[model samples]
Target chain A: MNRLFGNRTAIAFLVLPGVAIMVFALIVPIGFSFYFSLTDWAGFGAFNPVGAANYKEILTADPVFWRSLVNALILMAVTIFIQNPVAFALAALLAHISQKASQIFRSIFFVPAVLSVVVITKLWVNIFNPTYGILNKLLRLAGLKSLAVSWLSNPHTALGSVIWIIIWQGFGWALLFYYTGLMTVPKEIEEAAVVDGASWPQTYTRIILPYMFPVISSVIVIDVISSLKQMEMIYLSTDGGPGQLTQFIAVYLYQKAFVASQYGYGNALSILFVVVAVGITVLVQRLFRSEGEIQ
Target chain B: MNALTKTPLFDRSAGKRFGKFALYAFLVVFAILQVFPLLWVFDYSIQKTGDLFGPELIKLPLVPVWHNYARAWVDGKILRYFINSSIVVVSSVLISTVVSFCLAYATTRMVWKLRTLAAGFIGLGMVIPIHTTLLPNFIWFNVFGLINTHVGLIIPYIAFTLSFNTLLFAGQLKTLPRSMEESAFLDGARYPKILASVIAPMAAPAIVTVLVMTFLTNWNEFIMANTYLSTDDLRTLPFSIIRFQGQYSSDYAVQFACMTLVALPPLVLYFFFSRWIMSGATAGAVKG
Candidate 1:
């Protein structure tokens, strides 16, 4: 039995394939990415080694890089603050309603999240269209013509518009998480809190939110990572347009490498992207860690 | 029960009643905001391209221009892209799930050296976003002559998905009783036999969860497909709508139709398999 279970050939066949795929697809590429980052290769034959020059420029000289990094932070803040609170409140409201209504509303809200990112982005792009979009059209119909600005093209509104698309799609998932967490909160706790003459807000703040700390923190951690890594919606919607006002790290690196053909410089940007993603993920997880969370 | 009856669940005071009314009002408005945009998409998909220019919120064509669907399918290149998407997503989901199942079983059930480290390495892949590898992969696929091919795209899709897939399988496989496999082994059932008959049936739900998650990620994946595959035949579903929008810039109805076609399958899939996705996703979230 031991031989059968621990058979070296069996273990080798099973584990190595997955490990090999990961190493080839993930680990080895990062190695190549690092190697390429040291050079000034512009996607062609000969290239001189520029060791950290790209990094230096990106850190000190590059305004776009800073803009991208700041945008990610802004996204993280918006998701954690604006998105979560609203989703949590909506979820609380959903919980109060009958089960049937809650299910219907939940499913309806999640439709955008479940749709393809391309579809969602395109859908919103059409809605925000200055000329023919329903949003501007409706505003004009309501005699609010001045309010119907070009959402994606305008410098002031571009970042907010892209961020809105991201938030709108992700809002449902946030609500679902909070709702699920609320569901697991024991009914008896609320009953006890109320029996002690605690007001509704007091019961939620002390009893419920404390119990929901894990769910909330985990959601926040996900928000931080996703915010940093977000590229698809921004890429499809704005491509970091309006004087790079909407640039995020992923999209910025993509344009630099592929569009500008500054392959080496883009590689440098990507390494920094990974650093930020991992650093923030770890920091947030640490903040949320309480008894036994850390392995 | 007795304690609950004294205070009751929700207060019945006038202020509390007003509060409930306000909550309902907020929820209904939010629900409308959520569904209204989607309804507009359907509405516009049937309207004439000329009619779509109007400021009317809801416009119905005298005769619905159902031909937009045909144009999207034929002229927009959606059919081919849809096939490409299915091929890539299915191949990635199938291969990754099997690969992950093998690793999950090996690390969790069977004995091995450095098993925890192996599992950890696999799990670490989750954090490795595709952007990090985009340029390197572009160069790598360039050298290997894998560019613009479905295989090139599927390779990374499978690679990125393995971590989460393995996590799900490992979570489910760890909780399953070894007694089933052990008893089967006593009957001289080999690894393949035991896995197919004993392990797999038990992990079926998780397999579905992994399948759904992997499928959705690959199906909606835009950047990698956009980066790796440049040719028309190799374009995936997401790009079909984007490309259609660009090529037929003024054909708003056709663009909306293309978007609907791109969205329909996943919407249908969600409708049927939502319970599986919801329960599995929440469990995964809490555990993570």
Candidate 2:
């Protein structure tokens, strides 16, 4: 065993199988995407040499690209600003509850996170169905029949509806992070604050919140990354419909390549998607890093 | 004030009481909000097709229809999808765990020249979006004759999953004292023996984390399954549900029933292993 593994070549051999799989599965394919992006290749047709026409068109003339970007930004904003604070507050509440109650609430909140996205997406689709959806049914029962409308089908409302579903499905996850973060707060810190005449608000603000900086930063970063990569839910529910009001980068790239049959343009879109995702991730990490360093 | 006066005066007790009440109110409201849509699906699944599609705003089926599940299970071809999904998920999980454990061990424990470079190579996998590679992967898999095969799905799944798995395993194994391995060396145990008996047992929690994550991802995967598996009998639960929609249009009961069947296995697994999943997710988050 030592003879086999002690040699540098043997250690490299051990890593080779895994690395080869990744290269074959992901990296080489991406290289193909980059190569294909430079051509006018229909998914199944003869390819013509086009010198960066796909990238040029996507960057300059594509309205759908811009729409997808706008939608992604909107979803990211809603998740970060709206969802995070509410989750933080709920998590704070969970901290004060009895162990049994907290456990029950945690499990209840986490159901959506654990269930398949296919289940949640389909569930919301049925709920938002125009003709037979329960959303309309409930609205009419509440005597708000005039306000009832097709949430997923309307261009004006589609993005918001999609964002709401994403947030709703993900709310439990954010709450779980906060609850776990709060659980780690020492009891003596709270008691010390109280003995020093600091009110609960003050203690939470001055002491507990500061201690949770690391958790907050990590959760926020995860949210940003997940938000940027939002695909399955949007694909299942809207397919970037109602004239692409609900378009997201991930879904848009898929639609471009397969549905629209613009393989080169789709590859360009994908490369751009990677850049944007990495940029946002880095920016979030930088922002959080400074915030942590300042304290 | 009588007994409390012996200690420092605490004014926030009243505020803490308010905070506690507010917390309960918030938890209850959010809990209901979160559970209501799922409950609606549960209730809707049990209603007859005609009864469910009625003009009435909130139609309740007179008879609770359990055959929706029966039809989905016995008739809707869901058993095939479930089996397909199990094969893909289990195979991928095993491959990912073993490969990542070795790679992580090599990077962290073995003294080598290119260890940092190798680790960087693994880390690079995490940054590239999967959607970007789908088209090319299809072409490559086609060339390799892996298209529509279980290997086609499992290989990519394991590849995309290895970085996260490797990172977690490396972090976990790093915490195990090097002295144990050194002592094993003194006692004449081989590297594989130390890895299998000493490191593997201690790394159970990390392994569980990897298993849950890989299982959850494979079970819920849609894009690759959609793109790769073209045959009906080969579909996973997610793809199978899409098929059910296409074939059983307007049969809302059967659709819901199919959805329930697709959902129930994971739900049951989660219920039994909630603690493991929760801890794993949070631990992954922390390390990540």
Candidate 3:
């Protein structure tokens, strides 16, 4: 048993498969991506090395890349600032309500989160259809004829509409996180706060919110990463359409590589994307770290 | 004992009740908003395009057009995509689960020199977005003759998923008593035997959590499946649904029906295992 269990070879064998897969499928590919970012590869046939021209071009000239990053940042901001607070408030209310009602609403809220992205995006795409959508019809019914427009096509509303779909689908998970976090906040803490003459807002702001900071931070981090990686929804709905108004980095990179056949430029964009994503994530962690300590 | 009722600011009973009512109303409205789109899709799945328009947009189908489902399943090639999805999802889930289990076991249970390094390597995989690797993976897969193959898609799925699932398993394994494994070893149960009999059973809940999460993720995964597979026969459900929508852009009922078909399995799974799904999803938040 000692020989069998204590063997380094045995441990190596146990860990090898997962490590190998990650190295082969994940690590090696990123290395190749970095390598390819330097060349003018069209994804096929012969290609010439362009040094950092691809990167230079993307940094200075590519409006689409900038737009994609801006859209992702807007999404991150909306999710953290808008969705998080709303979900947190809803979760707090749900915590205060009856168990049966909370349970029902919890499941209802989570339905969109659990469903396939294709389904959710397509559902909204149809609903946002200008001519025959329920939204436009309802607006016309309410005699607000000017309110209805092509939700996904119009430049003014396209990003907002896409953001709504993303938030709607993602709202439940945020709610779930906050609800679970709120549930674990012991009753005595609130009771103690009340006994100390803390106001309702004061209790939440000074006590409960601080206590739930870890959960909040983690959720925010997840939101930032997810917002940065927004792909399938944008892909299936707008495909970064109406002149790339709703372009996300993930979708734009794919389009550049596969659709436009500019593999090298796509690689450069992806490499930069990776840097930005990692940089933002680390920054968020640090931001939360100092806040957690301060609180 | 209610927190709101006990608050000093809500001195008026009517105000407290009204506040509670308002909260409930807000929650209920949000709940409806979350679910109503899917219900709308369900409604559209059964209605003719003609009925889908006009004031009847909010109305249900007087007689259910059940044939829409059959048409979507048979004519839309959703069945093929379903099979393709299941094959890829099941294979990848099984592979990732087993590999992660082993990796977790080795890292947690054994005293290995490279354990921390191994774990860190796996953990690092999480931060790197899949899109960053897409171009290179496409080029590499094409070079390796894996283009338009399920194996091509499954390899990356397992790679990307291994980090999270392994972490979940390792967390579970750490909480299990080391004494149990030691006693099992003393009883002449070898590493493999101990793993199968001791660790596996103890980690059943974690295993299930990983399995369900992986299933939903693999089921919903679009970008890789879309990028890697070009052949119609190899395309997964999400890819197929997108293709079907593009091709039959005018057929609203069929498109809705096809979406329903593509979405049904995970919805049903969520309905049954909502707790597991919820916990698995929030696991990162709670643990991190």
Chain B alone: TM-score in each candidate?
0.90, 0.89, 0.91
lDDT (Cα, 0-100) at B268 in candidate 3: 93
lDDT tens string, model 2, A1-295?
3442365764875699889988899888888878888888878969887988888898899899999888878887899899999999888777777889989999999888877888899999998987788888888879998768889988878898999999998998888888888878899998999999999899989999999889988888888788888899999999999888888888998888888898888888888887888788888889989988999
| Candidate 3: tens digits of C-alpha lDDT, residues B1-288 | 888667656467768788888888898789888888888888988988667775744977888998888888886788788899999999999999999999988888788677788888888677889888888988777888988899999999999999889888888898987788789877878777888898899999999999999999888988888788888888888764676667877888888888888888998999888888887777778876
DockQ of model 3 vs. true complex: 0.63
Interface RMSD values, listed in order for every candidate: 1.7, 2.6, 1.9
- Where does model 2 exceed 4 Å of error? A1-10, B1-22, B54-62
Full ranking by lDDT: 3, 1, 2
| Two-chain DockQ for model 2 | 0.53
Question: Candidate 3 regions off by >4 Å?
Answer: A1-7, B1-17
The best-first sequence of candidates by DockQ reads 3, 1, 2
**Tens digit per residue, CA lDDT, model 1, A110-201:** 87878889899999999999988999988998999998999999998999999999999998889889999999899999999999999999
Clashing pairs in 2: none
CA-only RMSD, every prediction:
4.0, 3.7, 3.6
Query: By summed lDDT, which 10 consecutive residues of candidate 2 chain B come out lowest?
Result: B1-10
Q: Better model by lDDT, 2 or 3?
A: 3
Q: What's the DockQ for every one of the candidates?
A: 0.62, 0.53, 0.63
Query: Which number leads on TM-score?
Result: 3
